[model samples]
Target: MTLSSLPAPAAPTVSPWTLSAFWFGTAFHWLLLLIILIPANVVGFVGEANKGTYLGALTAVGAIMALVLPPLVGAHSDRTGKRLPYIRLGLAVNLAGLGVMALAASLMTGTNGFLVYVLGFLLVQFGNNYATAPYSALIPQLVPPSLRGRYSGVMGMLQAVGQLLGAVVAFAVGTLNLPVFVSFAVIAVVLLVPALITMRGVPETATPAPELAAGPTLSWQQLFSYQPFLWVFITRVLFALGQYSVQPFLQYYSVDVLNQKDGVTASSLLAGCIIVASILSAFLGGRISDRVGRKPVIYVAGTTMALTAILLLIAPGFGTALALAVVFGLGFGAFTSVDWALGSDAMPSAKSYARDMGIWHVAFVGPQFIGAPQGALLDWGNRQGDNLGYTLVFGIAAAFFMLGVLLVRNVPDTAHVKTAKA
Candidate 1:
């Protein structure tokens, strides 16, 4: 019933008996998760080099999937206490989907080839979403609310690392042919497997308090009546959609309009800039949020994003573009740094938290559908062939962040707020 009576929290045993292995495992898994997406975006964008319509549709599919699957999967994951099984299963499917993507990219060509590519992407989206919802849900279980910021921040930092590392490696490799694909595939397979092996417990942090949200039980619909939870959900969806919408298009705009010597060169450079800015900002913003309050941090990110969006609108050239990306990344890093802590604060029930989070994951995944394609369509329709569409997209994102700033204010302060007794 108390902390002392527990099994010493399993002592984090991993040969050397350190928490580093847990992080190492997480870093690797994070790589597997992020790199594929960056490269896929590069591939997809390059593939759409001339076909903006196709790119728009690609994101449209993701957006649709984002809206539909949450209640379905959220309900199911909630019923079950463990998330590892889903992770393993999802990775397995992802592996198969990657193989299909490789085959299609290598063998197929033309409009038909793009369709096959989309199908493979669909499989990937399903697998990744399945894994991610449960994966994020598992976080609150592994670490306490106190250490949540450190772990979340580190993971957030390393998440950028994974994206940057993958992008850098892909850039250095100089091609996306069979060999390059295999190299990443090896990384994905190798990292994904060890993450499960090192993590010994299932419910990794907290045991699902079934009494509050016991399932079999009800669907995620059980939480529909809980207004605070809904508020958090709305905030998350708006925030994610705005963020995701601007980014991929920005990557594309960077390559298409900026006249980089190489598209990969531009992507890798922008990625590096974003990653570094993100790490520093995440640390800075997170610490500030901890000291000042979460609302201020959200407001700062929203305001900064809005201003940066306008800057891009006014000056859509090389220096201005990178500047906006840097600012965007910093805003994102700050947001993500405290997001987990904030999410934990908002949850109506810690019982079945992972399942509840899986429902929340829908917001994170849903944006790819709405934002990405919309940007692409704007690009196609306007046919400016410049960064005009990107400017519009980010402008809309800034608006959403403003809305989020208002919403996040409603979330009560549940993070470490009081000083310890002297």
Candidate 2:
């Protein structure tokens, strides 16, 4: 069937509160994984010296799962014309993974523990991606083109709030020295409550079976030929690469570079600074993009992030690092706020919303697959003395941010381009 022949349902306008609720839980889970759970698990399993390499390997493997699973699941969701069912299934599986992870944490300090932890991590990745792939279609399916920037802003705000909560959770964990099982239980509750709220709050309309059967299908040839989507995808990949380069290693960086004895607390504080700053910028950035163009806001935001990363490289003390974290947060918030709007604008066909969004998701996870391996490089640089690995990695990240900013100029703004209906 031709794309133009498919029915275009009039999408009801949704409030920002309702539109952004689900992202709270999703972002919360991600924050915990990257900032708290995975790092601690790896460090406990291996001593500090080996932590980087092992953590990198574990993240790489998990990234592979994230890279591959979502697009396939989203395609299936498109075929079935269902999203909520997959979301529910994902929640169940994610909970089960948490249970396994709790068990693995109990056995910390052993090879067996590490292996079991890897298993749980993979399960978590699987569940999260499965849910997120289809859920990502909601913005395109529901919001009008004009309102997407505002909707995306609200989404970014909620996500930043979720990250803040995650940082709080990390603080509690560190202060109380919570047991592994207890920590997992806390995460499970945090994840479940918001997700349930979202499911109940957002309304979904299923495509009729005839429409589902006749909807335009995606092909490899069409995928590469879609210029706007391709450019957006590449830009997203570069931005994410810059993020992952610094994200997973902050705890180690605190301990080694800043000479902080309490790495967890220090890292949490840094994250809190970032999240707090991001919260301030996210909504404003989105709203601004609605008035100005997405590309301009992205240009400013990207430059800020790149500059802040460079400053972080030369920071002399933990206090200085904290300040830089806040600056980086401002840029990160604005970039993320407008990012979804840009991607939604670039979509080629409404019929393939889930599938295309899932493919776009690869731009986020795929970078982790490549960047996580830099842990080896980090270790090698540190071994050479003066913590040069961090300097090298952060430099690379800054370069990536600049490159992403430059490349984004090639993608036409939503106001100028119409989504393909072929």
Among all windows of 10 consecutive residues in model 1, the one with the lowest summed lDDT is 1-10
Q: After TM-score superposition, what is the CA distance of residue 27 in candidate 1 from its true location, in Å?
A: 9.3
Model 1 ranges with Cα > 4 A deviation: 1-50, 68-71, 175-180, 183-194, 197-206, 209-227, 384-387, 416-422
| Per-residue lDDT over 167-217 for candidate 1, one digit per residue giving the tens place of the 0 to 100 score | 565555445544535644755564465456534544353345434333233
| Model 2 superposed RMSD (Cα) | 2.8
Assess each prediction's global lDDT (C-alpha) against the native: 0.58, 0.83
Query: What is the Cα root-mean-square deviation between model 1 and the actual structure?
Result: 5.3
Residue lDDT tens for model 2, 304-403: 9999998987898999999999999999999989988888777767777888899998898888875456899999998998999999888888999999
- Best lDDT among the predictions, by candidate number: 2
Model 2 bad stretches (over 4 Å): 1-13, 204-215, 415-422
Specify the poorest-scoring 10-residue window by lDDT in model 2. Answer: 1-10
Q: In model 1, what is the error at residue 45, expressed in angstroms?
A: 10
